[model samples]
Target: MNRRTIQGKYEIFLQKYNEGVKKYIPIYRVKKSIHTWYNAR
Candidate 1:
């Protein structure tokens, strides 16, 4: 309803988004490594 509340929600959303990205990057790296290995073979 207010600017302060909206800002708070945005902060929370950013934190969750960053957390999700952190979780995703490792899996992405692993997949990339596997793909590279498969191609090499």
Candidate 2:
């Protein structure tokens, strides 16, 4: 594979990875907040 093609593939992978992270981060934040509140009690 050429450098350009490899870079393109990497970019696509990064985009998909970011999308997955974005989708899950809110859920993660909610869980983290709940955990912290429970621990604070």
**What are the Cα lDDT values of the candidates?**
0.75, 0.75
| Model 2 CA RMSD to the hidden true structure, in angstroms | 6.2
TM-score against truth, every candidate: 0.50, 0.50
| Residue pairs with backbone atoms closer than 3 Å in model 1 (clashes) | none
lDDT: worst 10-residue window of model 1: 28-37
Cα error, candidate 1, residue 13 (Å): 0.1
lDDT of 2 by residue, 5-40 (tens): 878989988999999998887753344345554664
User: What TM-score should be assigned to candidate 1?
Assistant: 0.50
